[model samples]
Target chain A: MTPVGAVATIGRLCRITRVTWLSELLEPGRMVSTAIQVGSQVFLTACLWTALYAHTEVSAGLQEHQAVGYAVLAVLASRLRPLSRDMAPDSFYRHMREGTILYWFLRPLPPHRYHLVRALGDQAHGLLWVLAGYGLCTTAGVVPLPDGRWTLPAFLVSMFLGQVIVYQLSLILDLLCFWTVANSNALHVSHFVQSLLSGAFAPLWFFPGWFTTANSFLPFQSTLHIPLSIYVGRIPVNRVPREVAVQAVWCLLLWLITRTLWKRAESRVAVQGG
Target chain B: MAGGTALRRSVYRLRLSWKLTSLNVRARLEYRVEFALGILAGILWQASVMVFATVLISRFPGLGGWSSGGVLLIASIRLLSHAVYGVLFANVNRLHAIVQEGKLEAFLLRPLPVYRQVVLHQFHINTFGDLAVAVTLFSLALRRLALEWTPFKIVFLCAAVVGGALIEAAVQTALSCAALRSPTATADWTGWLDHTLSTFGNYPLAILPGAVSGLLTFVLPVAFIAYLPAAVLTGTYEGTLVPREIALASPCAGVVLFLAARRLWNWNMRRYEGIGG
Candidate 1:
């Protein structure tokens, strides 16, 4: 599967995992009732989106396509967990000092893979709910799919780039846990900044001139706006290659930084007591 | 003697709470770098809203007969309300964490009222950033609109703004009580609600569909925060009640909501079977 497809599949599986656990945790009756209530809430939101879009001048096809892009972005962003201060160098170092990393080390999974799986498990259900809600919105004509024939190809490429950019940026934020104790506020601020800069809360077109000019050159825009613009047919089809090329460069830069940090972190990880 | 002693004790507690809150302010100020950055972040966030409004106005010229300055008045009031909420009731927003960690139990054990303790427990000193932004925006609006500024008009405007803040805090606290009963429901919904109110509240309620306008006016009382007051202030909404009665009464909705929320909180506290206890 392509990375986007993989992320989607993984996301769905994660949702299933959490749902099964939650079902078991709650009494069967309460589980069913809660699920139904949450489901209706999602449905209502979709209906509202649909109602709003119906009155607007935006075409139906564009709405549906845009909804899909939003869905994909939401799911991926939700799944890509940033490192919490509670679980970073201090916690990790303490765990290592207590020989706790040995538990995972002895297992078949590598530490990074283990962390990734754990994040997936933790976020699966929430991501699934978002996806299901997005799907409902799309079906209900709340989300206008793009009209142009080029929307599909452009969206697909732009989404891939968006995912890579977001994942890498999050990975870098997580890496910051290696150096700082109080990064939770930093993470929260970053999320807010990203939402505004990345075009998640609304389209980048809505931003002011100076902000638009500044954000255009940043990798943050690649995370959401690039794909959104593509879906809206605002970006020409010919630009897809160049956009993806920029995303690839970002991914490589982040990867190199992450690798260097991981090496440094490992060296710093002295088993003090053990 | 007993009554006098009891009165003294209550005053002492109030003083203690004030000191604690001030200490939090002091602690936040000590981190000059983080504090400065936080202020900058606040400005940036406010700029986003202003920019959004500017774009909308530039495109449409006017929304539902309201001028840009009028809209800014609404924005300023909304930000002011948010700042008040942030400063006074930060823990109300963090109810999920309080619930999850069994922190609510500690508040229960205290001699003070649960509502007071909960409200006073966490104070986000950073909210001064929002307050600063609101003041700056309001000042700009005053200049742009060039309203006939009589002393009474200024006093009424300030009252309306402060009252709007109180109401917002009350509504937020009341909604937060839901987390006490439904732990699984996302507390982030409060943020979503705030966003929805902030986004739609800046525009004239009349521009929205009648149903939506009615819901905001009656149910959410968001109209009182900005729209109605601005209307009265600008003479767009004509009535004997505009400045004298309605503006004064509008803040009461917040007070009523807060009183009801306090009751709900008390009831929820009795129901709390401490998490992991």
Candidate 2:
């Protein structure tokens, strides 16, 4: 493709994503629901870090200010992931169960492309909420900005790669719905594993050496912890390249995995008739 | 004759509920693999909570002067209360989904009390997973604390468990009632409430701001479910706005909440017009 054409394609995708996001934000009911959901998350993080920092001399290698950044960023970064990002009513399993997945097959577009487009919409919506949350927390003096000057751009790059990795991983879970009769339970288990290992609840620094060592091999850490740690300046600026490289590797591998699974899942799609 | 007839009718309703639950249980058993997978998932999910608590405490040896054992005991009580809630009130917890799908009409037409009907429509054995985790943690906490296990203490513990369960159910029922008015709003509210409990319930109440802590104690009163009970048992009840003596009233608090929630449920029921009646 020509460079101009490729740029145009990306711009169109961004426009579509923005439209979906604005519509959701404009809905009063949805806005209120989103506010409450986001508010509680920010409140929970504030309370947790406040409490943790209160009694402990220091947190998982984080000073008090860095602790607040880590806590706030972790919660927001969690919402930025694709597979589990907020505000989407139709999960892959739910659509498959109702046989509405066949509707996607009828479109001229490839299934992966269709899902990616829809995911962009959901991602935009979640990003808005995350920004709102961060703004609110900062204004309330509950969270602080990153101390390092170079951290902002590096954090953004890592966060972008981390989300790509999440999208691919979520695609794998979405593909499982084709073969498995019940995928909701699988989603539940994965959610627990993801939240625990990704350092959303607590930093990986606090875990036992063996656990953290083993976690280094998994992609979950790259999803939230690596990017978040970067934002809080826990990882040295020199080590940022290596951590980002790890995330990129996971993204490429999972993307290939999902591509293979999608082919198999395509053959298994049998629409039930009324 | 009237009293005897009323007594017989109540017994008959109770029998019907049991029969319905047995049938539901049998149907669940038919999906043996799914049922087994669900139980395993439940256990793993609950275990992850323990892992979080363990990791948190490993960093901070004693949370605000509360011993590690005291923290574990509090966490175990929260899980225990959750187990009881899951087993008994899981169906009621789905009221939002029911309201959304326009299925409430079927239950409203039933002869039995709507709450009883909702509670008995499904029997969840997956709660066993939560129960198992809770009991294991409770036992470990007991050993670490080395408290004397007298008959009176045993009885008090039993009552606390039941009371904690009741308190959780009352909160759940109240949320379900709230769903009847603004289904979507209350649904989100319930989710917020659940998030609040699971996230903050493990830590000492002293960590929260005074206003927020007071809300958890008096308004929502989730503290009575686990924190207060465990604190009373460990004799570490400090920094609470409420007096230490009131901590022992956890069981009584549960009963009061349940009765009050029942009243709220009935009031909401009268106003409910499911998706335009």
DockQ of each: 0.16, 0.46
Lowest-lDDT window of 10 residues in candidate 1 chain B? B238-247
lDDT of 1 by residue, B1-277 (tens): 9999999998998798999788766876655644565666666666656654554444434445567777787788778777776777766867766776577788778887877777777667457677887888888778778789889777777777777777777777777777786644534456556656666666566555577567778787888887777776787763222354665466566677778877877777788776522
Regions of candidate 1 where Cα sits further than 4 Å from its true position: A1-108, A118-142, A206-210, A267-274, B1-11, B22-46, B238-248
Tens digits of per-residue lDDT, candidate 1, A200-231, equal: 55456645678889886788888777776776
Give me the displacement of residue B22 in model 2, in angstroms.
3.7
Query: In candidate 2 chain B, where is summed lDDT lowest over 10 consecutive residues?
Result: B181-190
Instruction: Determine which window of 10 residues in candidate 2 chain A has minimal summed lDDT.
Output: A81-90
Deviation of model 2 at B66, angstroms: 1.2
